[model samples]
Target: MTPREYCKIFAAEARAIPDFGAVPEIIPLYLIYRPANTVPYATIEEDLVGPFERYCVKERDGSLAVQSSSEIAQKCCAFQHWLYQWTNGNILVTDMEGVGWRITNVRIATKLKGYQGLKESCFPALLDQFAAAHRCNRYCEILGLKSLESLQQPAKPKGSKSPSLGRKAPSAQSSPQLQKKGLASPQGTRKGAVSPKASRKSTEAGEAQLAPKHKEEGSC
Candidate 1:
């Protein structure tokens, strides 16, 4: 089934449980790929692969229980089938009992020869299918799951200056100097001669004074 369908089934099944009020916890499925020629680390392989195999076995027997009260066994089985198909049966389950849940741990070791075609086709298709199936927009809200927007650095403001910490003060010699040169001093000028009105008034006053003198001379 498609990833959305899987999620819907998962959600519905989770809702059917007695106390399934919150979203079901999703555990990370780890798969490691390595070259076949190298000697396998037995302890690491055993630690990782054992639990996953046990979980598959228990899940196959209907003994696995999830928090969801609904029929999630079919969904889990389908998921396992898809995983096996993707891995081309090279995937091995290593652990299951430690967490007391049916979460499978997986490991993959590549065979050097006769698997070139399988690796080229199956690996890419598997990744594409897995990406298509489980991808959800809801992961945008998860903490530490960054988005494209988050990857961008914030913009800096224009003309920003560094703080004046532990720097020397400006020197007084740097102050602007007024240039004094051979400039001529302004000479004060005398006021202009009397206005036309004043001149006319003075002439009229002199004529009035001569008229009185003429009238007195005629009387004499």
Candidate 2:
């Protein structure tokens, strides 16, 4: 069944229960095919248990337990039930001398019409679970499935900071004191050309300095 159809069915079934509170959001179910490596028990446990422990309560016997994993337990249990119904417990469930859980029976059901729907909906949800359990993106690549990274939008470049509007713009000609301090220069005097009066005064000053030096040399 397609994920949408399965959700409808689950919702109807849940609503039929008397005294049940409002039906929660339907969790997406995924069929995982682990042909070579089984997903670890720790990974599954952590995904279902670690995040939902806040819902757990202490019993009268002082034992702590939860009714279920937050909302995802519904999805997980449903998927497990579906797997059991389809595979009849003949499927491989392996553990290499207490190393970890590994199921080698996972494969894409290409013949079924609902397969693509499940892949599009359930696979990503399953990938999220795997990712939450610290599985790398290559986990999908190994299964010949699209990784979440492939579907993500490319990161946009950061914008350059704009000038603040509060500060006043500098004027073309600054204060005379600033010019004297060499922090600012008058725009008109930037050219190398010298004024006629200033040039004449400089020439006269050079002549006056040279006359004293020339007189001393002649006297020597």
Give the alpha carbon lDDT tens digit for every residue of 126-220 in model 1.
33332333321332222123333322345576895678856777655554441222333233222354578899999999999899888888998
Q: What is the lDDT of residue 95 in candidate 1?
A: 19
Clashes in model 1: which pairs?
A: 48-94, 49-93, 49-94, 49-95, 50-94, 50-95, 51-94, 51-95, 51-96, 52-95
Each model's TM-score, in the order given? Answer: 0.20, 0.20
Worst 10 contiguous positions by lDDT, candidate 2: 91-100
The local lDDT score (0 to 100) that residue 123 gets in candidate 1 is 30
Off by over 4 Å in 1: 1-41, 44-136, 148-160, 164-168, 173-220
Taking all chains together, the TM-score of candidate 2 against the true structure is: 0.20
lDDT of 2: 0.36
lDDT of each: 0.37, 0.36
RMSD of each: 20.2, 19.5
- Extract clashing residue pairs from model 2: 33-106, 38-102, 38-103
**Error at 37, model 1, angstroms:** 17
